[model samples]
Target: MPGARRLLWLIPLALVVTGGLAAGATFLGADRIESDLTARTRDALVAAELPSATVAFDGRDASIGNVPADQRGRARSVVLGVAGVRTAEVTGQPAEQAPEAGGHVKRDLQVRLDQLLAAEPITFQPDTAELTVQGTRSVSRVADMLTAAPANVTFEVGGHVARVPGGDPEGARTLSEERARVVANKLVEAGIAEDRVRAVGYGDTRPRSESGTTDLDRRVEITVR
Candidate 1:
């Protein structure tokens, strides 16, 4: 009788151990699946040249981030095409636009442009309208971004120069204008339509610094039109 009781107790203990092992195996398998999905999705985005986009997964659903408004559809499609992704949601995008929302879209593009230039300002050779190597690269990136923008959107390339003691205002204006033209031409060469861009020179009238002229004053700025 005592042996029968002992056997019953051992049977329940064995079952409990087996159940715990199964639960652990299931959890580990789930983790591995999520990891594989993340890597594959990232590789797919990079292959599509949307490396700036980020992704995260919850089960089979994916959340994609940092995708530009114009590229949202493409990013979502790319993610959804992944083998394990059941659904994809693009985050951080502007809402569906109404006809009256044109201004908002323009503003959003302007902010993006500003952030790009802030990180990588377009530079030129000393006192010449020629672009440096870095400046050329920056222009190329700008071109790519603008190429993705809406067709109705336009841009203004504004150039400004620093003020110096007894500097020739006329000369400054001419230099600034030439710089603007050079940048505009580079944009056109890179793929932007000429009709969509306008170049203007502000000369020393728009110094970025209130106290004195700095290197920043001799710079170029882009505005959405």
Candidate 2:
């Protein structure tokens, strides 16, 4: 009779052990899977020069942010390639509009222009905000481009900087602000009203490079809103 009583006690003890193990397994498995998913995302984005992004999973639905329309297709493609990623909720991609859509002509141009600006940042003297000879030439061309743009459109200058080697923590902000200001001033010289052009510096607060490389992360984007 004592042996049977002991057996009953063992049954509940066994259940408790099994339950604890199942919970631990679940926690570890989820952590491992998400870590792998994030690494894969970083690799693909860095390779493509797309902005850095993050993922959050609640069950099989993964939320992804910081992608542009030009790169959203790629994001979806790569995420779907990962095992167990059921649905990817992607946000922050620029809204794509066709020129033939009429009212969207300005927005369409903005997307293309932002892409161009990201590819090339206006040149400056080493460690200084002063524009180089080449930079002046670039801005001159930009003036003409802005002059030709729809008069009703408002142009915004966006400046981005990275946490760089040999650069002060506040330096990133100062440099970015100056860069944006210089461009905005040039636009005003090109005949655009000061109010029509908004100059805003994002500093190192909004980094775009997944690889953390300063060169690509330091950029200025011109957008129409």
Candidate 3:
């Protein structure tokens, strides 16, 4: 009878372990789904010229913010179009007023910039500020975009570097600054007004990824102002 009792107890224990594993897998799967959905939705928003909008997800449902009142419909439409997005809730300023020209132009420029960087991010050689061939091309494209932008529109060229173990922080800062200056100089050579561009360096301070230094960490970002 004792053996039978122990067998019955072991069966429940096995069932409990199996159930716990299944729950863990389900949680992980949901997390992955949410992450994928967020990426796709952001890309879609950028493609639709709504890059300023921010997206957050609860399961498959998305909550998008920062969209202008006039653009909520379009933002929601694009978010819904992304596969696996079950629903989208868009919130922003009420659509009672028309969007101003400056606001519209800024958003347009940001969207184009996001699209360009997404396809070909500007990268530099390891431990140096030298631009790779592809990086030069990417900078050229950005310069072209800036030249076409409104004269009042200005941009900031922000430089960043990946953190290295036992590396000199001051050296990292200097390298990032040089990289920013290089990109800013190229933009000027491409006919963009010198005064319209500003350069700043963030040395291993703002990492895009926590999984150590990546190529993405050693890169430049352009922000419309």
For all candidates, what are the clash counts?
Answer: 0, 0, 0
lDDT of 3 by residue, 1-225 (tens): 999999998999999999999999999999999999998888777667564579999999999998777778888899999999899998656433323339788998899899999799888888889897888999988887887776678889998888899989999889899889999988876666678799999888888778548888878999999
TM-score of every candidate relative to the true structure? 0.53, 0.47, 0.54
Where in model 1 is the C-alpha error above 4 Å? Answer: 1-101, 210-212
Residue lDDT tens for model 1, 61-90: 899998778889999999999998999998
Against the reference, the lDDT scores of all candidates come to: 0.82, 0.69, 0.85
The residue-level lDDT of candidate 3 at 109 comes to: 86
lDDT of 3 at 151: 61
> Best-fitting candidate, measured by TM-score?
3
Residues forming the 10-long window of minimal summed lDDT in candidate 3 = 92-101
Top of the candidates by lDDT: 3
Candidate 2 structure quality by residue, lDDT tens digits, 17-89: 9999999999999888777777776555554444345566665667777766666777777777677788887
Clashes by residue pair, model 1: none
Candidate 2 ranges with C-alpha deviation above 4 Å: 1-103, 165-168, 211-213
On lDDT, who's better, 2 or 3? Answer: 3
- In angstroms, give how far residue 152 of model 1 lies from its true place: 0.7
